[model samples]
Target: MPQTIAEKILQNHTREEVRPGRIVRCRVDMVLANDITAPLAIKSFRAMGAERVFDRDRVALVCDHFTPNKDIDSAEQVKTVRQFAEAMGVTHYYEGGNVGVEHALLPEQGIVGPGDVVVGADSHTCTYGGLGAFATGMGSTDIAAAMALGETWFKVPPSIRVELYGTPQPHVSAKDYMLRLIGEIGVAGALYKALEFGGPAVEALSVEGRMTMANMAIEAGGKVGLFAVDDKTVAYARRAGRSGNQVMAPDAGAEYERVVDIHVDDMSPQVACPHLPDNVRAVDEVAGLRIDQAVIGSCTNGRIEDMRVAAAVLKGRRVADRVRCIVLPATPSIWKQALKEGLIEIFMDAGCVVGPATCGPCLGGHMGILAGGERAIATTNRNFKGRMGSLESEVYLSNPAVAAASAVVGEIVHPSHL
Candidate 1:
């Protein structure tokens, strides 16, 4: 049977070409560092008695978690990472507003691509799989080893096939389906596995929507979340400037430990209530849930399409006086495109605060702070207590349309109403 793109990336990096069921040691092609994890990784690499990296140019360090200092601790942490990146000669250093979220910035740089094994200290590193790379997250210790030796070991995880069979109804988004998946599989269900999403529903989705879905694979607690390298993947690669034709898909009889079937016709916009991603509810169930804010950006759904969707729903409509809406582009390149597309004007006219292209206010690093007992409806991934801003603040996770609609009404309402 032919292998999937995830399998090809793994095979290329394998120290030994064992069959699908066995474990293997691999020479990783790249390692990543972010503000939160780089300092610890650098410290551990030095303690290993390594004078310099195996190859400094192959490693990436991004200053995103605390850009321009959200508070005193973030500023101090930023200082530690900048000094470390400078001393180590790492080539990919993005600082202040110039820095996008770690996941959003790495793939844009052409450093990550097909048939490569990539590891990062951040959990969402699997976002690179959209390029046909086998990417996974690691702890500081694992980051240090990859940074020093450029290799790591991984058990070849058995695959699971998830099929979305029909076209979704109008106004539904990828985030909605992802939240519903987490609800079905449960948070701990897909642990240490690869989800190969296929069928018409998946192939029809745009690359940005596919990335939005794959990025949250970790939310279901899966190690490497991905889709087969179909035309959509190839087209995205070309547009992003990587320009490759190495898309891969598995054979009909390929082995999958599990198969999940999600029919698109029955699916609707989903909302993840506070505290856990898997705690998903339909939009109608929470129709009356009042919210204080709305956000439409993150590594998950902050791409250009996401911005356009919000702009379409908010044009000529004013934001509720009580609700604050903010839109952030995933990267500077996406921001530039959104500006070119005039989405920024629609948002500003709706009274939305368009933030710069950084991880700003996503993790409370900077921007969009909320007071105690407040509530927000956001398009970004994650809603753990205090994730957006204040610890006492509450967040409701939803698709961009729902978020925009809620912002207009100052309460939870379906975007289809307008």
Candidate 2:
């Protein structure tokens, strides 16, 4: 039987003919956890009486969330992870200045690559699927087991083919296309299913853009978001110093539960309003809605491409009075690149705060929390209640360009408007 990209990867990992809904034990290529979750996994690993991980090189621990020692509790959390890494001799550990958001950092370092089966204790682990990997998030407990055994069980997910057919307009991006998809399908639309993105439009997106789309797959209730390996995938792996030959693609006539087609030629910049990621609207619909803050970074849109877009819009302008604009680079390397490219200078001149590489404020941890009744426009993925601070505060989700343009006007607006 022909298999989809996700099914092919699983079968390659398990050496079994895996099908949708079949429970299979598969060897994982990489396992990761962040400071927020690694401590719990470490405790569980100890409880399981595992003295060493199955393979230290395949296990990664990142301290991105609430890092820079946010507070006494967060500092202690990092301390526990650091101590555990030292004791375990874990080779892929990252923290302090070396830390980046786990999702972005792993792929950039070639730690997770094409056709790999990766599991992380963070939901956005699906981001690796953009690299043609079969990646998904698991609980800390499951992660501990994977770290100890180098294997985990998964019920193979049926695939949903999301076919894209046209080029996005200026200032529109994968974030907008993803938001439009979520709006059309709702949050539970693809529950427990693999979303296999394809077609000419999707092929045209940069790897960074593809990752941004996959990073929000969980928001649509997807089990995993996958893309077929292509030249771009190979080039990206090569740039990351990975020369692995583990590339796979869906066979023709592969099965899919359904197909969702999106024609993006005329698609406008999209936004998700407060309370849910699926509550999306065209940027014009919410134009003039005042915002108290505008955040231009996160795992979703904190790459170098995102930074350049935001900088282009803010180059000759300043953030509007009373609106605090914060720009965060997802990793130390990206931060340094931005500085070298003078993107940092543009942001600083525009009165935007350039923060370190952390998940900051996206999870309401720190850096730019909102007060009650205030509003923010962010490039972060989620906009759930209390996600960025006070429950009463609102979040509007958009691409980097929209967020930057909104910052200039002190309200939600399309980049074209400014």
Best by lDDT: 2
Q: Write the per-residue lDDT of candidate 2 for residues 1-418, one digit (tens) a residue.
A: 9999989999988876799999999999999999899999999999999999999899999999998879999999999999999998999999888988888899999999988999999999999989999999999999999999999999999999999999889999999989999999999998999999999999999988999999999999998999888888889999999996455678999999999999999999999998999999999999999999999888899999999999999998999999999999999899999999999999999999999999989999999999999999999999999999999999999999999999999999989989
Where does candidate 1 stray beyond 4 Å?
Answer: 1-5, 18-21, 243-245, 389-392
Model 2 RMSD in angstroms? 0.8
| Candidate maximizing TM-score | 2
RMSD of each: 2.0, 0.8
Q: Cα lDDT for residue 25, model 2?
A: 97
Model 1, span 1-418: residue lDDT tens:
4665556667777757745567888888888988888878878988998777778788888877666566788778778878877887878777865687777777666677655688999888887766556888889888998888878888787777788888888888778878888889988778888877888888788767877787888888877877777776676666656764576777667778889998888777899998788889988888988888888888887887888898899999999998889898878887888889998889889999988776676676677877889998988778889988778998888999999989998898888876
Against the correct fold, how does model 2 do in TM-score? 0.99
